[model samples]
Target: MSLPDRKEAEVRRMLDVPHPAVPPDLAARAAERGRRILVRRRAVQAVAWALLLAAVAAFAVWAAVVEPWVVPPADTTPPLDGW
Candidate 1:
């Protein structure tokens, strides 16, 4: 019983050991990577927006010149009048 308790205590102590702190340069590198990711994201977003605007402009041009939409003339009287 005593031997098992001693081993258990030793295992608990080993598990509680403090981990080494991260190096100062590691934090700077992480910040630099984050900035790069942000820049890439912004660039991708700008390209996506430009593509969307171009598609909208193309659709508008198509609707205006190639496939023109015309409204039918209104009927003078109602279709159903009496019960």
Candidate 2:
């Protein structure tokens, strides 16, 4: 048989076999695990947002106190002030 025909025959043979029985509580168990994962994801997102906000507030406070935009005073005096 050709390669494609052999592959098709194999797939047909596999499909003819009976599928295994699933557990009755499989859906419920999967749903419970999904809910737990969602709760954890939401909690992590909330903490991340809170930390981002706190960082922005801290930077604002630091900038206000330090005033980085203003020029600093010169170190040496001019030479001809007295004459």
Which numbered prediction scores highest in TM-score against the true structure?
A: 2
Give stretches of model 1 more than 4 Å off. Answer: 1-15, 71-83
Per-residue lDDT of 75 in model 2: 97
Assess candidate 1 and give its TM-score to the true structure.
0.61
Candidate 1 Cα lDDT to native: 0.91
Candidate 1 per-residue lDDT over residues 1-83, each given as its tens digit = 59999999999999899977889799899999999999999999999999999999999999988656677568786688687
Q: Which lDDT tens digits does candidate 2 get at residues 1-83?
A: 99999999999999999999999999999999999999999999999999999999999999999999999898998799779
The lDDT values for all models are: 0.91, 0.98
RMSD of each: 7.8, 1.9
For lDDT, the strongest prediction is: 2
